[model samples]
Target: MSTSRHLSAHIDRPVREVYEYAADPLNTPKWAAGLAGSIEQVDGQWVADSPMGRITITFAERNQYGVLDHDVTLPSGETVHNPMRVLPDGDGAEIVFTVRQRAGMTDDDFARDADAVQADLHTLKQLLER
Candidate 1:
């Protein structure tokens, strides 16, 4: 059994612009402060210093459909896949992030994860709309 929560934000920008910005791991530290402390490219792979220690960020291949799926490899050798996207919505764009509940996580912890995802999306909206 898998459980996930979807959080989204409407950004006043084109889908391409929003997707490009968000898909770039280098820019994660700006909006995803809670997730990424610093990001650097090591051997062509994006790595970041996070609360969980150094993690590798693997992104999907560049595409026209605004798919931004990625996997985060934790220091414990655990890899978590995150599904994300920037979709065209009227004149602007809608960014969506899927938060998956880890095994054995309490309900309160899952709620907090949702809240965190929402907060990060809000930050992304503000940063892009500026």
Candidate 2:
């Protein structure tokens, strides 16, 4: 069965600030090192050169609700949906990333994925609050 793990970080920035920053695909290379070593916009899509090879990121339409969902298409042509959101929290905001465990993946792999997401979130928080 497929499963997903949700990880989050509290950033000391307003919801709009956090959402706008994260929603911009260009910022992926700054905080998501584990996913993309380098990312650039190409043909209206965010193309990433990652350790896993070249992949493309397609983000959802920008809106006022702080939704930052996107899809990652691997070199294998398999696409994975990433659900992320930024929510207002007092004077700051909470950023959440949902990590979906791929089919046939082992527990160790799932754990590593979660850890990676956590690390990415921490990195994003540090970058924003710096």
TM-scores, all candidates, are 0.94, 0.95
Candidate that would win on lDDT: 2
User: In candidate 1, how many Å is residue 12 off?
Assistant: 1.2
lDDT of 2 at 85: 92
lDDT of each: 0.90, 0.91
Q: What is the lDDT of residue 54 in candidate 2?
A: 99
Summarize candidate 2's per-residue lDDT along 1-130 as a digit string, tens digits. Answer: 5898989999999989999899887888899887898998888788999867999988989999999898999999999999999999889999999998898889899899889889999999999998
lDDT of 1 by residue, 1-130 (tens): 7798888999999889999999888889999865788999999999999867999999899899999998999898989999999999999999999999988789898898788778888999999999
Model 1 clash pairs? none
- lDDT score, candidate 1: 0.90
Q: What clash count goes with each model? A: 0, 0
TM-score of 1: 0.94
Candidate 1 residue 43 Cα shift, in angstroms, is 2.1
